[model samples]
Structure formats: structure tokens, C-alpha cells
Target: MAITSANQLELLQTAEAVAREKMIDPGLVVEAMEESLARAAKSRYGAEMDIRVSIDRKTGRATFTRVRTVVEEDELENYQAEMTVEQAKQYLSEPKVGDVYTEEVPPVELGRIAAQSAKQVILQKVREAERDRQYEEFKDRAGTIINAVVKREEYGNLIVDVGAGEAILRRNDKIGRESYRPGDRIRCYIKDVRREVRGPQIFLSRTAPEFMSALFKMEVPEIYEGIIEIKAVARDPGSRAKIAVISYDNSIDPVGACVGMRGSRVQAVVNELQGEKIDIIPWNEDLPTFLVNALQPAEVTKVVLDEDAERIEVVVPEEQLSLAIGRRGQNVRLASQLTRLDIDIMTEEEESKRRQAEFEERTKLFMDTLDLDEFFAQLLVAEGFTNLEEVAYVDQDELLVIDGVDEDTAGELQARARDHLEALNKAALDRARELGAEESLISFPGLSPQMIEALAKDGVKTLEDFATCADWELAGGWTTMNGERVKDDGILEPFDMSLEEAQNLVMTARVALGWVDPDELARAEAEAAEGDAAAQEAEA
Candidate 1:
């Protein structure tokens, strides 16, 4: 509609009111109004004309203009938007070919349909501005706690009224047994903030381990002050959780600070968590020590760690096995997560039986392979000789150091060990050749003789097989005999290779076999050609 002087003032006031209500700048609202008016004006004026509208921020007075650019006579294409330089000079004293000129056009009296269209445009702009405002307000608030009142429920998700915004708490993010009614005030962690077509969506979570850590930060002054640091946290939301904390100040006990006086600090956190039991443990750099603390209230008899496998074997008293494992293995599971290690729990009885079995197996292996009697085999086993490889590789002096073994006896043992290894290698090579193992694979720089034999046994007898083998397979793969995925000790049959060594061997095989991507090879050739060309040009 036509804007009278009174209506202009009313428009400015309306724009300001909407801007304040929507938490957006007043200038943005006025700009939206200008665009809406311009869109409506296009209907009255011909749509082919370059039309623009501007609203005075203070006065709310609207101005419409028809825009045209000066161009050379030959360059003039659209008469509506471009004019000849000679024609442009008629409007100005001196006109350049690139200069723009605007002529004031009377504001159109918006008809019923045009007014409705303009109103929709303005509302859409306001909605968009509100979404942008919300996104900017909440994006940085992710990973922090926020207090909100439950506004509504849709399906299982709770819509909560956060300050100046609304957020959704999905069912999966809520504590298992917790329920909320409308208008219930609750605290939750801001898990995510996403900008969508509808608006900015703020996602809240009460089940995240970080939520528990945040609550501890809020309740424990030491953590907030940075005297005590929360190292890691593992949670079974609404059931049980464990937190590892360390103290920067030597005198301050991190666990004690978290526990608070008379258990007040921890109790505050526990109450917030819907009574989820929390175990506060002091963190140690030593993994085994930290694991012992993580499996609290369960006495650990010994901890055997396999660093390469990132696993820990925890042996406890027979009576303490259930305690260490917890009800349904929750205790060990949480400890594993907290320590970032795979944990296997066993009782003293089980460990003892395993040790005895291993001892007997080794005794038999030495007797059968080395042709040693039971007495000599037991003596070698007691001296920590586990296998033929160690016996063959150790210095002759090492053998002499064993009790009841003289220099002559050590010499005979060493000769037998060497001879046995040589005969084994000869047999393995013969078998590998029969299996069609490629000469290139056998002679590859890093593939040990034993590794070549292992490859043959595992059906990796060709260069392509060596190239295509996955890193895990090359590194001996997992131990699957027990119906569980367990780490191998890198002893793949006749060879023991480290993961790094295995990776290098695999890469070498790939390069030798030209199994790498053709595109990468092409790129490398192109790079080399360019480098050579540059060098020749420099010399010339």
C-alpha cells in the first residue's frame, strides 16, 4: 500500500519492535522491508527493469529507483539495463562508459495480492534472521551444561525451553530411568547445535560421560580451580561410572578433593546423576598401577601387560574374581574403557593351571626337538629357554651359564641348535618352492627366510599374494583358536616379526610387484619429468 507520512513513522516503529522481539539488528529488519517493497514494486513496473528499493533507517521513508549502466554503443545489449555513452551524457555533465545512473520511480500502491506477497517476504526474512541469531548464540555453547524447563514432548524426545531458545533432549541421551514432565527444570549437557531449515537445533544429553565430568567440575572446587584434573571418565549412565583424576599440586589429594568433606562433593554429583554410583580413582602414568586403581575394591594379585596388544591380564584371588569382574562384567568393562586397554580377568587358580600347562608343553617341545632327556629339558626350561629360536640365537656363553653345563656340553648344544635350524630352513625352502612361492618374494630384502616359509604355509605363495596381504595378516593376524579375537605375539610359524617390520615388508612387496595405484605412479612420473625439465632449463 501507499505509505503516507504517518504510515512511514509507523513502519519505522514496527520494524524496531520486530527487531527487538526477534533479537536482531533494526537495520536488518528495515532492509528486509526494503526488499519486500522492491519485490512488490517489480509487479507494477515492468519486471525487465533493474529495480531497487532503499528504506531510510531513521525515517522509514522508502525510495524506488530504476538502474541503468552506461556502455559503448556497440556493447549496449539490454535497453532496460544499459544505455549508450552519448545517451548517458544527457543525464549528467560528464559520463563514463562504466558509470551507473538511477532514476527515481514512484512507489507502487501495493494491491491486495502484492501486499500479501510482500508480507510473506518480510516474515520469511524475519524467520531467517531469527534462525541465524539462534545459531550464533548457541553454537559455542556445545559441550557445556545448560539448565532448561521442559516445554513439550514429541514421541520420546523432550523439547526444553532454554534461555532465549528451545532445545531437544532425545530419548537416547536421557538417563535410562529418568522421566520429565512439562515445565520441569532440568540440567543437561549441550551435546550439539545444528543449523537446519526450520531453525537452530540444540541437542542436550544427560548420558554422556562428559556430562558427569562437567557436573564434577561444577561441584568440585578443586577441579574448577585447576588444582585437580579429570583425566578420563567411563559411564554406565544412571547406573555406575568411574572417573580418573590427577592432582597438579602435590599436597592436594585429587580423589579426596572430589570426594569432598563427609562425601558432600561426590554426593552432589551423585544426586545430579540420578544416584549413579561413581568411583573416583587417582590416575597414574604407570598403566598397571592405574588399572589396579580403576578396578577398585578388587584386590589384584598380579597384572601381566602385553604392550603390543594393548591388553592387560589381571589375576585376582579366587574369591575376588567375581568382585574384580563385577556383576555382569561391568567393573572390568569400565576399567578397560577408562584405561583404553583390553582387560582379561582371571583367578590365581586359573593362572596357576595355565602356567603349569605351559611348563609341561615347553618341556615336551625341548625333549622332542632337541633330543634332550627330561632332566636336561627341565634344566633348560628353568633357565628361561622357552623355544628353539631363543636356544639357537643365544650366545654359547649363555648356555654355559646354565647349571650342570660345561664348555664342551655348551659347544655340543650350540652345534645341535644351529644344525637343527639349518635343516628346518632347508625343509621350509623346499616346501615353499613346491608351493609355487615366487623367487622375487623369497629374495625380497626384508622378508626373512622364516617369513617366506610362513607365507607359503598360509597360501601367500605368489608375489601378488604377498602384495595383497593385509597388514594384520602380515603381522601374524589374531589368535582365533580360542573362539575369540586375541592378539598374536608376532610369531607366525617359523618367523617372529614386529608390526612395523611387517608393514615395511608389505609395502616393499607392493612396490616390487607394481601393485600400487596407476594414477599415483603416473603422477610420480609426471613430477619426475617436470623436475628433469626444470633442471635442464636451469643449466641452459
Candidate 2:
């Protein structure tokens, strides 16, 4: 109860034992005891008085003190804690305001209620220290795999003991309903380590693609030693997975290294993942070449990639269609994920039909706009002319390359195409006016008549509306919703407007309407350029 010589050393001994058991610093436990004793002293010596406590680390001695501060007369509120400078003369010769005065005080005998309160305070502090230690230990361990013993299962989620703390493996994070009972040792990827109100939560996942990468790294010494790098991983969980690997040394084949001698390395990883099938493919810098490899076991005839859209079209043989698509579209889906591109697969016959359809459509457009015969239109389409604008604006030399096309015929073709385009422009302007397109937007410097008509039809009729639009809203974008990428069609996207062009047009509109200052815009752009340069330098 009291600070007697008999039990003075008991305090330090208890702090050491608790700190050792909790795997925390003994200083933290001592600090908690100091705070708990201070609270007890405050209860014993009037609650209004300021009480403090300090414990000696060596001798386990407790020192109690009462502290009061000298203050101005008007600021003197607590008589026991704060005092007027004039009244402080009894304690010191020339006490000035803002000075603290302390006197030794006797340690209090703890009542049953006070002892219980002190115990609770120490327990709370110890718990907080333990949580901090756990978070510090596991925070950097995220993104790596760990072997843990299953502690229990809650609502289909597994709680595993991970040496220092417990980690949760969510039901969705497990591999294809693979269940584990208590005391079962499981390997999982530490997906995240987060500190919360309750404690630090370590989220583990066996279904994460990184888990497969880690497994390969463990099974293949080439990967662990950095001779081979895992470039990408896509998983169908317990069913199948694809990993792309690249070797830094020319002598080593990354895929062969991962497969090991007679399939020993890959078999080890597959067994750990509940018999998940893995396709090890070589990584390539060329995305199209890599994609052909990713959709492996299925031979591709041709690959047409649209870099701007991050989409690729693969033409395969009719016999390979089913193999490329796989059951439930899993093969193509994994290939898409591995390449980070949206893939559209078609048989060679389907691709030929598509090409024929496009050719007929373009030939028809030339016939209608250029007033040419079907044979002449077919000749134009065969010469790589897809639109009337190419005919109207192309050099005469380009048209002369066509067979049986002389100078006079080329002139006639261009004249008719120009006349038709002018008529179309006039009709678009008239339609825009009918739809309430303002002159402020119509007379804008960069927008064409067709662009104005499109904007008017989409309710972006005024200059103010155009100025308020975002670049992506006008140029279209891909958005990730729930995991899959969804396309957003833009008003100006049909005109093939790029995001940068949309941004420039919108900024020009803002400047013309007195919304943006040109000088400030220049300064901001300069600062942005400087920031980019600095970042590039740092990265280099």
C-alpha cells in the first residue's frame, strides 16, 4: 500500500516480468506505473492539486511531489495549483510569474478502489504498447508470404497465429473453398497491415496473384536471386494461373528455370496452392508478341493492337477458337490480365469477313460523296482511301498512283469530294443553329462546324458549358468499376479527339471568356514542367 522499503524492489521486478512476457520495453511499463501512481496521488491529495510521480530505474524508489505555478493575480484560479506572484514570496525570495514551484509530498496508501483503477490504467497502457509493437513488426512484412498456424475460424474466415500476432484470412481470400481446421499450417500472402481502433489487422490472402509470384520465388532460386524476374501474374485462384517471367542473363530461360528439372519446382508451388495449374510464359518487351505468348497453347495468326485504347484484336484459326477462349472465358481473361490489355479474339474467317465489310462500307462512302462509279470507288478503297477528306485534301501525286487515273480525273474527284464536304458543313451549321447552338460556341477558334453540331446535340451548346467540361468527358476514358474496365463514350470522342486536344480547347474557351488569365496559365505550366523535370531527374 505505502512506499515501504520492504516492497520497493517489487515494483521494478513486476515491471521487468510484465515487459519480458509482453515483449515490450521495460521503460514503457515503468512509465505506465508512473502515470497510474500519479492518478492515485491526485485522488489522495485533493483532486484540484497537481500531483506527479517518478520511479527510479535502479533502486525502484517512488517519488511523489506537489507542483504549483506562479501566475498573475487575474489568472489565479486554482489556489492549490496556481498562485499569484505576490503570494509566491512565502515559497521563494523573488518568484516571478510563469515559474513552477514543487515540494516533496508523502506517498499515499492505496485503497481497494484506487488499486483497481491503477491496475486498469497499467493494463490499458500495456495493451497500447503491445499493439504498437505488433504494427511496427508486421507493417513492412506486407506483400510477402508467411507460414501461419490456424487458430480458429470465424464465419468462414480463418484466424491464424503468425508468431507475433494473429492474421485474418478472409473467406474471399481463400483458394476455391479450400478449408482448414485449427492447428493446420498454411502459407498465405500478407496483403496488408493496417492499424485500427481495435488493434493492428494483418490481412492474409491465398488467392492473391502475388502469392503465386512469391511461391515461384521460393521454389526457383533464379527468381529469389534476381537472375529471373516475375513480370506479371494472373490467377483463376485454385483452377489455373499464368506467370510471366524474364531472365536478366541470356543463358538462362526464365520459363524453363521456373519449371525446373522434370517439373519439380512448379510441382512444389502447385501442390502448395491446392493443385492450381500454372502456365509459365516468357516476358517480352513487345506487348503484341507477349500477348501471343500469354494466350498460349492457342496459336494466333495475327494481332492488331490499338495502343490508345489499350485493346488488342487477336485473329486465330477456327480450330483454336475454343482453346483460346477456354471454359467460361478463363484463358482469354487471364491473358488480358497478364498483358494489361482488353483482348478481342476472333477466328481468321471472322476477321476476313470483318475486313470485307469495312472495305464495302468505305467503297460506298467514296461512291456517294465523290460521285464516282462503283468500279472507281472500289479502286479508291483498294488504294487505301477510307474517307472523302483524303480524296479532297490528298496531293495529286497520291491520286495519280491509281491505275487509269489521269490528272483531269483526279481533279474531278477532289472537286466533287470538296463540294460534298462543304454542303455537309453547311447542313451541320444549320442543324446546330436549330438546336440553339450559341454564336459564342460556333465562332470558337478551333471547333469545326461538325464539332459544333455534335456539341449542340449533346446539350453542350454554350461556351460556358464547353469551358466547364473536363478533358476526359470530351475525349472519353476507361474507368475501373468493381475490377473490370468500362468504356465511357464522350461527346467529341466520335471525332477522334485526344485528351490533350480536349484540354487545350477547353482552356482556350476559358481564356476567351475571361475566366483564365493567360499570364497565370503560363506560370502554372512552367511550374508543372519544372516539377516533371525534377521528378524525371530523381527517377533517373
Candidate 3:
């Protein structure tokens, strides 16, 4: 209706200036303002009228354009409509059927409604533009560390001012033993960034596994140069962590390099993690050995591995079990994560028991075929001779050197030992007959009658017969005669006494069992009597 005051013109320029500052498309701002003006115009001044608003950048003034659709003569209530083409053609040269004309509407008709609508539209456009800008700036920073200032702490979460905007550092992501005050300079890992209604929201973390890796890269020069690679890292946050490092150059010690001078490098990393203990261990190509090292501070005696199963059984002393497993199983748990292997730790006692059981099984097999005393059996055991070949390999001097043995005695022991050893390979029943063992030997205390019976039936009839039995098949079972008895007792002990007291018994049984061959016992006795007579004759 009239020229507006300076304030009205300033409002138009303010919108333009904000649009420029935000780098929004100029057309978008114009569209927003026009929509706002139209809403206000329709509500304030009746819907019958048309309204258009424009801002003159050069003149800084407001202008409006109002138009009406061309309709037929009967459309009298169409306050925003004009005459049809046929009527307009009488006053003008070229008028189409639907031709409409425009006229300027006064600004007074817009009133307060248009102003409010215009303001809302401009604000909406600005917010959308800001969100787009923030997204573009932050999306590329994922997985990288960013330096920021601590704005403040809200409910134990750090609100970091990462230049572009505030990023959230959740309580769990905050290092356990570290604190930062407002305006403190800090570093955080960019876990994620997402565009939200307010702006680009960033998620930052201080306790991430990658954070430890990044710290190592900064502290260890070898890591930065790529000579040593961190294969994997597992952390217990504030308390402890395990890092598996490998050297591409074998000459360079991966563990030593990561540890640095007196652990200065790792210590630095630990300090940064707020005193979390860090273990820098060499990563082994062999998973079993690698896992052994991973569960450190615990000494491993043996590593039994199941390659196809991807499992490792590590045996350690009972004293080291707690250390290897760590408090609350932290050490082994971290090792599992680092090596990706299922790890089992056993104590020395366990492995020892297993080995002892195995040794007993072999001894039982040898004892199954021959009747022998415990002392004689143990003498063979003391020589580390578990089987016949071991016995055959021993020399006379070696046999004599066995405790409680002399040269002549060693000779006898060797002869009897070999006789017993060779008989294990005989057919089971023949072996039993050779050793003078019967179904009765199986029924003795501490002897497995069923096992002895099985051995006898299998043609392993004597202690020697049992020795050659496969260790797998030599397992002793319970019997009604003797519960959980050893197979060795049933097979090896046929004589009632020692070599001294049992000489006559040995002689007799050897004859009865066919062990001395036909009448050789009597012939040996006669030969001994003759030798004694000749010695007496010589003395006279």
C-alpha cells in the first residue's frame, strides 16, 4: 500500500545475509520467504485474494504481485478471477482462452500472519542446510582419533567440543582411572558420526581396542615403521591388556621392540591408558606356542595341541595355574581372544598322573606273560627297559651297574630276563604253560582275572605274552575275584619266593612249566654236583 519503514527492509536483508552465511542455495531462501508470505496473506486477508512478496536486493524494498485466473462470465463470486479470453480479446491483441493478468497487492493486506510464516520457513531451511553441512564434515572421520577440548561433563559423560560440534564420550568409553576437567585438551577415537535433527552427532571412545593399537603406534617406533605389526590386542580396560605383535623382520625381536627400553614404550602406552598393565608378547606362527605366551606370567611345561580342532592344552605347574589364568581368568580370557583358539590349562600333577597311568599300563602288559617277583620286575623298570628290545640293548656292565646287582648275579638276571622277555611273543596258551601260569594266577589279589583270561584266550598265555599286547588292549578291568586288579600281577608273578629262597622253587617250576626244556633242570643239577666234586678232588 505504501513505502515501508527501514525496519521492514532490514528484515528482508537479514534473511538474505543469513542465507549467504550458511551457504544455502539462494533460490531455497527465496522459495521459503514466498511460501511464508502467501500463508500469512491468505489467513489475514481473506482467501479470495492472491498475494506475492519479493525482496529487492539492490533497493532493499518490498514488492508484491497478485494475479487472478481467467474464468467465464458466470463466475461472479471469483474475487481472485478475471474475464475470459473472449472478453479480454476486445481490449487486447493476443489473449488466449485461459489467459490471466496480474496486479500488485498492497503490503498492508499481509499483516502479522505473513511475517510469522515467513520467519518459520526461513528457520526450517536454515536448519536443513546446517545438518547437511555437518554431515559432510564429519562422515569421513570414522575410525580416526580426533583432538578436542572438554566442554564439560554431563552425568559422567564428557561433552567434547570437537571444533565442528559437541561429541559424546559415554562413561563406559571414558578411561577408568583418568579424569578431565572443562577445557582440558584430550584425544578420542571416532567410533561413529551420524546426522541427526540437531546436527552431526559424534560418538567418541577412549577405551576401544583400536585405541590401544593407536597408542602403541605412537609409542613404538618399530610399529610405525611397519617392521613390527600388532596382530591383535585384547584389553581388560583399566587393569590389564594383551597385545600380540609379530616381526616381519625375524632379526628384530618383536616383543623386545614393543617393550622398548626397560618397557618405556609400553609403559608410555600404559600411562596413557591410565596405568593399565600391558603385556607385549611375540606372536607365534604356531598357535599353541603363541597361546602359551599369550597367557603370560604363567610358565607352561608342555603344550598339547589339537590342530584340526583348533584347541590347545597347556600344562603348567599347579603353583602357576592362578598366575596363568589371571585374576577372574583375565589372562587366559585375553589369550583366547588374541589367539582365537580354545585354550585349556592343566597342572603338572594332572599330566603326571596321566603319564603314570600310561607307564602302569605298559608294565602290566609285560607282567601279564611271566611269573615274576616285584623286586625283579622293578629292577627291569629301573633300567628303563619297558620292553624286550630295551632289555636286549643292555650290556653286561650296564646290567651289573643296576642297583643291588653284581657281575655273576647280573649274568643270571640277564639270562632269566631275556627268557621271560622272549616268551611274551609266544601263542597265549603256550606262553601260559611256559610260565606255569594258570586260570588260578588270574584270581590272585591285585590281579585282573578277566584281563588275564582275555590274554590267555588271545594266545597271550603268560607275562611275556601280555608284554607284546597292544597297550590299548592291555587295560585291566574289575573282576568278582579281584576288584580293579592290575594285569601285571596276574601275568608276571608265578614263583613264590626270591632268587635266593626261590632257587629250588624256580628250579621246580621251571621243570613243571617246561621253561627249562626237557629234564634240563635235573641235568643242570647233576652238572653242578659234578663240578663241586671235581673242585673237592682238586683241593685234596
The per-model lDDT (C-alpha) reads 0.87, 0.94, 0.70
- Which candidate ranks first by lDDT, i.e. highest? 2
* RMSD to true structure for each model, in Å: 7.0, 2.0, 23.9
The Cα error of candidate 3 at residue 85, in Å, is 12
Candidate with better lDDT, 2 vs 3? 2
Q: What tens digits encode model 2's per-residue C-alpha lDDT throughout 1-540?
A: 787777879999999999999999999999999999999999999899999999999999999999999999998899999999888999988999989999999998999988899999999999999999999999999999899999999998999999988999999999975988899999999999999999999999999999999988899999999999999999999999999999999999898999999999999999999999999999999999999999999999999998877899999999999999999999999999999999999999999999999999998898777777899999999999889889999999999999999999999999999899999999999999999999999989888899999999999999999999999889898999999899998889988898899999999999999999999999999999999999999999
Q: Which portions of model 2 show Cα errors greater than 4 Å?
A: 517-540
Candidate 1 C-alpha lDDT tens digits along 323-432: 99998899999999899888999999999999989889999988888889999998898899998878887888889888889988887777787788888878878888
- When 1 and 2 are scored with TM-score, the better candidate is 2
Q: How close is every model to the real structure, measured as TM-score?
A: 0.89, 0.95, 0.54
Best by TM-score: 2
lDDT of 1 at 72: 92
Error of 3 at 513 (Å): 66
- Which residue pairs clash within candidate 1? none
Ranking by lDDT: 2, 1, 3
Residue 250, model 3: Cα distance from true site in angstroms: 4.9
Estimate, for each residue in 376-395, the C-alpha lDDT of model 3 and write its tens digit: 66666756766655555577
- Give candidate 1 regions above 4 Å deviation: 71-77, 457-473, 476-496, 503-540
